[model samples]
Target: MSVHEEISKKTNKTWGIIQTYRKLDEKREAEIEKVILQCQNNEAFSVDQINKVTEEINSFAAINHLPSRKFVTKQMVEEAAQN
Candidate 1:
């Protein structure tokens, strides 16, 4: 597959996984977050832990298509507000 196609496939997979997680009860989401936090707090992360974190982070990131608000300038916000 081409690079673009490969990336699209991976993104779709991540999005599907995230949607599955969302469909679960909220408690499960909280539990998963707790586990993620625990894994992250370890001094050294295992390869599996790293991979899981990376996947979840990427999946969460895929939820948004817009650029980060951190990059928004005061002028940009003012202009937007004026509209």
Candidate 2:
């Protein structure tokens, strides 16, 4: 697959895993600060730690590939309106 597609797929997969095991705190916006994992267990992972693990999937891959904001276009808006 293309790099863009690969990145998107890899990033999304990693994000999904993160969502299942951990989540960014209220102040994590725009910053790879801390992601609390297993809140009841007091577990957490930092950006660096996450990157280290994600790198196992791809040498150049990192959890940071996740999108910070949704991209929307006129066509997309129209498509959503149709739906």
Candidate 3:
């Protein structure tokens, strides 16, 4: 597979696993959705911001050899929230 295809497969597989375990907590989901919508409306989610976040997450996973959900860190979440 190509490098792009490999990354895409990995990402999709990871998200699939995450989705299986995710509990649909309505309130939290709604809050997250609201924040995402606000960011979208404000054009706060820029391409560089996305790339930085993705790089950080990928680095964390590579350094730790962690599974997808475990790749998420408090620091990562905080950085994303601030952006």
Residue 37 error for model 2, in Å?
22
**TM-scores, one per candidate:** 0.31, 0.27, 0.29
For residues 1-83, write the lDDT of model 1, one tens digit per residue: 89999999999987886665554324334444444454455432223433444455445545644211122233433344344
Candidate 1 vs candidate 2, lDDT winner: 1
Quality of model 1 by C-alpha lDDT: 0.47
In terms of lDDT, which candidate is strongest?
3
Candidate 2, residues 1-83, lDDT tens digits: the string is 89999999999987786563334322232232233222223454235443443334332223445433222333433343344
Ranking by TM-score: 1, 3, 2
For candidate 3, write residues 37-72 as lDDT tens digits. 555465443334334444544555555464432223
Query: What TM-score does candidate 1 reach?
Result: 0.31
Which clashing pairs does model 2 show? none
RMSD of each: 14.6, 16.0, 12.7
lDDT at 74, model 2: 36
Residue 12 in candidate 2 has what lDDT?
A: 95
Q: Which segments of candidate 3 are over 4 A away from where they belong? A: 1-45, 68-83
Stretches of candidate 1 above 4 Å error?
26-83
- Which prediction has more favorable lDDT, 1 or 3? 3
